[model samples]
Target chain A: MTFIDMLGAAERQNHSMLCVGLDPEPARFPGRLAGDASKIYDFCAAIVDATADLVIAFKPQIAYFAAHRAEDQLERLMAHMRRVAPQVPVILDAKRGDIGSTAEQYAIEAFERYGADAVTLSPFMGFDSVAPYLKYHGKGSFLLCRTSNPGGDDLQNQRLASVDGQPLLYEHIARLAQGPWNLNGQLGLVVGATYPAEIERVRAVAPTLPLLIPGVGAQGGDAAATVRAGWRPGAPIIVNSSRAIIYASSGDDFADAARREALRTRDVLQAARADSLRVATP
Target chain B: MTFIDMLGAAERQNHSMLCVGLDPEPARFPGRLAGDASKIYDFCAAIVDATADLVIAFKPQIAYFAAHRAEDQLERLMAHMRRVAPQVPVILDAKRGDIGSTAEQYAIEAFERYGADAVTLSPFMGFDSVAPYLKYHGKGSFLLCRTSNPGGDDLQNQRLASVDGQPLLYEHIARLAQGPWNLNGQLGLVVGATYPAEIERVRAVAPTLPLLIPGVGAQGGDAAATVRAGWRPGAPIIVNSSRAIIYASSGDDFADAARREALRTRDVLQAARADSLRVATP
Candidate 1:
């Protein structure tokens, strides 16, 4: 199935918008897995097993695995995710950006090597950097719009001198992803959940495109506000939570605790979606 | 020594502004090595050994290795560079950009794990993303400013609305790299060799910062113009040529041919520097 089709199917099947971000920290792994980089797959796989039905998608942050020379484990984890929870789409949170042939190689890494359903990318290098990923027909890619980080303001919030209107940099990125850049209907924008107003603005601009909204749990974004601002009847919002869910407990019940947190967050998001729909209909 | 110190020492020792970019594609590998992903280390090591003394820096694009799942090979190649040519610094051309702990993980992947002297990063996420790399004390990073790709104009060339003269996106990045963002003097800018006038403009804004200028060889960026626009007395410009030098031959004499290509390119860049200096002085 195409990535968007998978997202919609997973959302309907799971009845959730929660995307559990698998940003595994070996040092933070509980009990026997603590400080063991080799068990990255085991830790992440357990979380995936516990929360597969609870999440609309699974997001794995590449740096967390690569940092500990655990790419093989990541490959294994990706395989496990596909085998166990094929219904849920996996977004590789790589944020990779380059040009031409090099960008092609990265596309191979994310799609062929890791077998990710979608990959997150940085939009700094513009269309050519992004164009390479679009060549992979059914796969999806998200451009970093208004990120949750405070430093995101250093560029994303700046006003652009466009003849039509002086739109903010993120707004320009949103419009591009919504219009000219979405050639294959595989484009999406990563709007951080921390900025609900910005999320609203992006939703207005890119009404139909899916939004990967991170920063909900530990990053302190209000789940209800994020859903309220970003959700629409046809549009989708994949709200991500990494640390707060994965590290819900420091003891041996880490996987169980993660499941509990995932369940809670997923329900909260579902409730928010229902409230948003009710208000919109009224 | 610090990364900048290694850069200066290598530039003086080699009398070259040329940086040999190690972007190994197995399909493009020479003779018996062709189509063998396992020989990535052997292929890259041969190139590094051949042109070690002809370069100011050795840039190994991470995507090329990671695409083939040859990151372990990259680790070995990094060790090989240190063993064979300790004077020439290695820049892991990752172009990684993230925030918070994820950024720290990437820093670890580049600095501690790979043992790279420097890394390339995308400045799209702003300061917090770039900040983690700076915490590595002596290590250096080049932020993508005006890239060589045609799509670079999509955003990098856009005018930013400010109280002062409306600077293009790239100029704002240059100013930031020159000023507040460059904590510990460990930052540089990646301005494409294809855009000589843009390089000159960047140099004008950030007079003393090091510039990693890629795009010379196969990409058809003019070497002399690149050197003339970017080269200045103490402010080093690393002119990179990857495919042309590395794939100079498809025969048994590939390494020797690579050395010849690297030597020829090095001399061309050195001559350009001398001509630029002569013009400046006259």
Candidate 2:
């Protein structure tokens, strides 16, 4: 099945818009597992097993694995996720950007090697960097639009002088992802949850594209505000919470704590969706 | 030693500005080694051994390694380059971009794990994303300013509405890299060899910063024009050629052929530097 189909299925099956981000820092692992890079797969698998039924998707940040030379472990984790949670989509949060042949290599790494349902990309290199990922007809690619950081204003907020009208850089990215760049109709935008106002602006421009909203947890983005701004009737918003969910506890009950946090955040987003629908109907 | 110090030393030691990119594609591997992903380290090590003394730097494209699950081989190659050509700097061409903690993880992945002298990054997320890498003191970071791809014009060429004056997106990046954002005085810019005029414009904006100019051979960038536009007495320009050098032959003498190609390209860049100097003197 296509990534969008998997996303919609997981969203309905689990009744969630929440996406748990697995950014495993060995130093941050719980108790016995702490500082053991070899246990990366073990630590991440527990979190996946605990929260698999509570999230619309799972995002595994590549750096976390590569930093510890645990890429082989990541391969095993990818297989574990596939076996355990076949219904949920997996977004390999790589944010890779390159051109032509190199870009194709990255596409192969993300889709073919990792078997990811979708992947994230940086739009700094433009169309050709993005086009290669679209070739994997069923997979989805989320372009970094308005990221969840103070530094995002440095380039993303700058106004672009266009013949038609002056639109901010992020706005132009939104329009492109929602229009011409959505070649396989599986394109998405990564709008940080910290910027609810900008999230609303992006939704206004794109309308239908799935929005992978990060920063709702440890980054101080309000989960309710994110859903209010991004959620539409048929549209999807995979609101991600990394540290807030995965690192919810430092004790042996870490996986349980993670599940608790995921469930809480998911309910909060669902409540906001209902409120958003009510306000829109009125 | 600082990355800048190493770069200067390598340029003088090799007496060349050419950077041989190790973008190994197994399907294109020579004869007996053809379609064998396991030979990534072997193929790249041969090229490195052949051209180590003829070039200023060595760039290993990480995607090419990761695509074939050859990251372990890449690690071995990194060690091999350090041992065989310790004078030359290695640029991990990852083009990674993210914010805060995740960016920090990527920084560790590139610097500590890979032991690279420098790494390429997309500056779309701005200062915070770039800042983590600078914390490594002497290590260098090259921000994607004006990439060497046709799709680059989509975003890099657009004029940005700024308070001082309107500048293209790439110009803004150049100004930032050359000025405030270049913390620790170790930041550089990646400008394509294909757009010689843009290279000149970027050089004018950031006179002292090193420019990693890709697109030379296989991508159709003119070496002479690239040097004329980017090279200066104090600043260095790393002219990169990947396929044209590494895959110079499909025979048993592949390494020898790679060395010949590297020698030819290195001399062309060296000749251009003299021409540029003579023209400037008159």
Interface C-alpha RMSD per candidate, 1 decimal? 0.7, 0.8
User: Per-residue error at A124 for model 2, in Å?
Assistant: 0.6
TM-score of 1: 0.99
Where in model 1 is the C-alpha error above 4 Å? none
- Model 1 interface CAPRI class: high
How does each model score on TM-score? 0.99, 0.99
Candidate 2 segments whose C-alpha is farther than 4 A from its true place: none
What lDDT tens digits, residue by residue, belong to model 2 across residues B1-282? 999999999999999999999999999999789999999999999999999999999999999999999988998999999999999999999999987888898899899888999999999999999999999999999999998687898888889876357999999999999999998899999999887999999999999999999999999999999999999999999898999999999996999999999999999999999999999999
TM-score, chain B, each candidate: 0.99, 0.99
Q: Summarize candidate 1's per-residue lDDT along B1-282 as a digit string, tens digits.
A: 999999999999999899999999999999999999999999999999888888999999999999999989999999999999999999999999999999999999999999999999999999999999999999999999999788898888889996268899999999999999999798999999887999999999999999999999998999999999999999999999999999999987899999999999999999998898889899
Q: A1-282 in candidate 1: lDDT tens per residue?
A: 899999999999999999999999999999889998888999999999999999899999999999999999999999999999999999999999998999999999999999999999999999999999999999999999999798999888889996358888999999999999998898999999887999999999999999999999999999999999999988999999999999999988998999999999999999999998888889
B60 in model 1: Cα distance from truth in Å?
Answer: 0.4
